[model samples]
Target: MTFEVFMQQLANGISIGSLYALLAIGYTMVYGILRLINFAHGDIFMMSAYFMVFGMVTFGLPWYVSAAIVIVAAVALGVLIEKAAYKSLRDAPRMSIMISAIGVSFLLENLATYLFTGVPKGFPDIDILTRAISFGNVSLSVATVVTPVVTIILLFVVLFITNKTKIGMAMRAVSKDFETARLMGININRVISTTFVIGSALAAVGAILWGSKYPSVIPLMGVMPGLKCFIAAVLGGIGNTTGAVLGGFILGMSEIMLVSFLPSLTGYRDAIAFIILIIVLIVKPTGLLGEKVTDKV
Candidate 1:
């Protein structure tokens, strides 16, 4: 490929990777605190897209207003899911929580299909977002250039919250040792709920950018991206936020470069994350930046 083509693909990879990173952050934050994979997280992402569709197309709201509604709705849904599906089972066995997560995921998917009729909806176009920018030889979509910048800004915001704020301190305490954090007078439930809210909001942002990029919304739309983002989280060290971002960029770049170099493998692009997940699990289970934690007997 030519240099311009390579640059264009690189931009595409970063844009896509930024979305993965956003979703992976949610996964990592939830896992860090609850040790739950939250299989339904992707469904929440899907729901946010629908929420946007409803807000904009059904209600005739502007894109910004619809986006705000979607973010708020996603936060509420995340908290609700945690309270309804996860709270009661918090003391249950790990397997039980995992099953609940899976059930929740399936429920959301089926419910969406039933309500939306399984027909894909065309995402409304926003000229400002969908417009392409040309810089010399490299041409890129507005979202492509904007997504990574937004992801980085949000990453910093999250880091600040986790490291500089009181709630962040509480979160760190909870993640480090849940029982000890409770003993020290931390509201376990609040910390966990806050984590979900933040994660879900990020997912909402991701869904918006994703819709802008792909322009189609379906009930099952989130499944692949969710799984791939989960893989990104795993590759970065499941509980590590910075690692999650790094892994996302790596996965995105790798996938793009793979398709560019091996055009025949284009059809197998989705498989790339799975293969990476397997390789990471076999080679370094703790992930690139993940710390190895030993369970007490």
Candidate 2:
């Protein structure tokens, strides 16, 4: 491809990558604290879109108002899921928690299907997001340009919260030793709930941007992105926030470039994530930036 085309594709990749990074951060944070895969995370992402639809179409609310409500609802739903599904299983076997997570995912999917039906809904158009801006030979959507910038800003905010804040310190303590932290006076439930709230809010942001780009909402919408973001999390070092961002960019660029350079493989776009996951597992299971941890006997 020519330089201009390459640049355009690169921009597209970065835009999509930003969304992946946002979603991956949530996965990494939950794993960092709970060591739970949270299979329902993607379902939460999917639910955000439906929330937006209801806020806008069903309730006839303004865009900004609808978005704010969706985000709050996402946070509340995430906390509820944690409380209802995962909390009781905390002392149970890891397998039980995993099964519960998967069950929650399916339950949300089926619930959404029943409420919204299996048919897809078109994401409402926002004028600013749909508009295109040109930079000499290359042109891009407003959402494409805004997404990466927003992602970067949010990344720094998250890093600051995790590294510099008091709660962040508690989170670190819990991640290192849950029992020790609990004994030391840290409120374990509060920290976990905060993590879920942040992660779900990020998912809401991603859902908005994703709907802007793809312009479709469905019950199963989060499955592909959810799985891909999980792979991105693993690729970046499962519990490392920074690594999740890096993995997201790399995965996004690779997928975009693949389709751009070879149109024939466009159909296999989803397969790319699995292929990368396998490669990452075989070559560097700890991930590019993930540290190797040895379990104590």
Give the TM-scores of the predictions, in the order they appear: 0.99, 0.98
**Model 2, global lDDT:** 0.94
lDDT of 1 at 243: 94
Q: Residue 104 of model 2: what lDDT? A: 97
Instruction: Give per-residue lDDT, candidate 1, residue 92.
Output: 87
Total backbone collisions for each predicted model: 0, 0
**Candidate 1, position 34, lDDT:** 88
1-297: candidate 2 lDDT, tens digit per residue = 899999999999999999999999999999988888989999999999999888888898888999999999999999999999999988787789999999999999999999999999988777688899998999999999999999999999999999999999999999888888999999999999999999999999899889889999999999899999999999999999999999999999999999999999999999998999999999999999998866533
Whose lDDT is greatest here? 1
Give a tens-digit lDDT track for model 1, residues 1-297.
999999999999999999999999999999999889999999999999999999999999999999999999999999999999999998788889999999999999999999998889999887788998998989888999999999999999999999999999999998988888999999999999999999999999999999999999999998999999999999999999999999999999999989999999999999999999999999999999999875533
The root-mean-square deviation over C-alpha atoms between each candidate and the true structure, in angstroms, is 0.8, 1.0
**Best model number under TM-score:** 1
* Candidate 2 residue runs with Cα over 4 Å from true position: none
